[model samples]
Target: MKFYSPLKNTICGVLTAGLLAVPLSFSAVPSPAAEADASSLIGAAIGGIAAHAQLNAVLRKYNDTDEGRQEYFQEMKKQLGVNEDYALNHQLDRIMTNLTAGIGAVDPSIYKKPYHYFINNDKSFNAFCTLGHNLSVNTGLYQTLTNEDEIAVVLAHELGHGQKDHPAKGARRSLNMQILGAATGTQAGAVMAAVINNRNITKPMEREADALAFDYITHTDYNPGATAAVWQRVLDLSKSQPSSFQQFLSDHPADSDRRDTYVRRLTQYSGGHVTNSDGIVKVNTKVFTTPAAVGGMSSKERSYFVMGNLAAAYHNGQNKQEVTVDGNTVRMGNQPIMTCVSGDEPADTLAQRLRQIK
Candidate 1:
């Protein structure tokens, strides 16, 4: 439920004089070799049949029931302070609608049960998904995203976690933590304590999720490049701040290497096709049509009606102009203007005028 970084305290040293800071001494730093050795030992200790049995026992405690899922959701909600109803319905609805449309089609089964969305309202850009289609997105992330594609990248990554059954594996991990806590001394206890208190398991699970998500979205209209783009944006946003003390960086733990991983993955999937290039994936904006009416007489339709209206308004040196369609009126100016009436405008006429106006 509450995921945390395993090396959080070590990498970012303890608070001193009310300020969180990293210790400067290289001697205090754990060498990469030492960290790898600890990981191997832990992996071996938890690899045998005994560990599997313990994990199965813990997993059996909660599985395949509304009660079990409800308990899990409650725990996460408490930890994240998420509004369950709104998250499960509203935000998820928007995400599902966009993803389903973007992908062109999706398996109907994926939509049978409503998905959940969790936002921590923190300024850090981090997102993850759990079992049962539960997703968490940070508010700090929303601020950085320029469009829906960036958000899609985050959601698709989390969806990868659910598709790969990461939560079920997480149950086994919880068991491993319990065993390590009981068997080893205080250092192990500290590790287990961190695990129980939101320690991020750096044990290849998140990487697997990233890879799986990369694969999944490649089959859809969502550009795989958006994955690398979002991270690059986050990286740039971090440099603008005083320090990279944000939770997004802490929990997700991204670096230049990870960004390169996404780029490599995109290249591999695209087969030399650039993602954002015109020849690769072209968005068919013509697919979208204005609705019949907006508050009456197609006010929304007039928002994109004709180039004469646009040219008149533009050449008149007016910053804004009011347009009325029946009782409904909308202000228009710099935006390319068009109007919709009962009949459709001829494509050639509209195209010629649009070119002249431009």
Candidate 2:
């Protein structure tokens, strides 16, 4: 079923009538002052009830069945236009396939209501999974993230929301809170819009999704380190262009916090060899390379990512293999650790250092 906003005039009229009746219902009380207080309480109670009913009605349309979900998906796609690019769609499809397989390996019940997803034409670096496991990716995400693992990290985060039904839970929680506030413009339509657009997800829920994304990535062939790298990349980008990332940062946890969370998690695989001191990546209580800014990455931001790669190498047992140098690139087994840039040490020297340290 489709949901539409109630007309402003109709809502205003009902609210006005309710307010007008408040005093009359309490008029029989002996004290005028007591009547006035009672009226105020009754008016607030009535407003809350009205808003709650309207919001619940909107939430009820979010059905879990396949047919009901397809109906909702069609309605949403009409507003969020579909991307016509076959290549982009194919890329998203391949990523989703890999991610779903990973999720299935972790928990198979999520497949009971198979996901429906598509790439939207919206040119924003954001994606959301709404009710019924219906997901959408903005085309602008590709503009920012070219790496498959980075993109997979994003899609996996949304899948975590779907797995836990965060969208609907967050929506209900938001609507109820707004209803209790019942301030001007705290209408059901406004709350529902924010909920569907994914603005209402709480910080705690964001953290949960981040952790789940890391878990899902570890289950797949994708580098689990990308979870930290993606946030570090965002933190680096925001340093240069703060306004571009303000909206996302405001809604989610601090990028530094997210980067650190994943980085700390990644250290679990290193058997205590890898550690992060402040924002710097360290090895065995010794100072490793202090990465300089490369491209958009700041010195500290890049360090976390380098730490992530080192952690992933350990996790994959690549650390057990020979450390090789191919021109500017340093590799542990098949895993590339770092490519010596203009400001960094020579590749062969770095490889020898890795042999000593790792």
TM-score of 2: 0.76
Per-residue lDDT tens digits of candidate 2, residues 115-142? 8998877676888787778888888888
**TM-scores of all candidate predictions against the true structure:** 0.52, 0.76
lDDT per residue (tens digit) for residues 1-358 in model 1: 2443332343123212111121121112232352345654454354323434533543343334455555555565666665335643465567656664443343344554445656754556566665445666766565566455557767776766665556656645654565453323223224334433434434376677667655555555454555665565555556676254364455454655555677656544434321222111211212222324333223221222221233233434432343323222222444333344345444344434333323
Top TM-score: which candidate number?
2
Model 1: which ten-residue window has the lowest total lDDT?
A: 18-27
- Sequence-dependent TM-score of model 1: 0.52
Query: Which lDDT values do the candidates have, in the order given?
Result: 0.46, 0.72
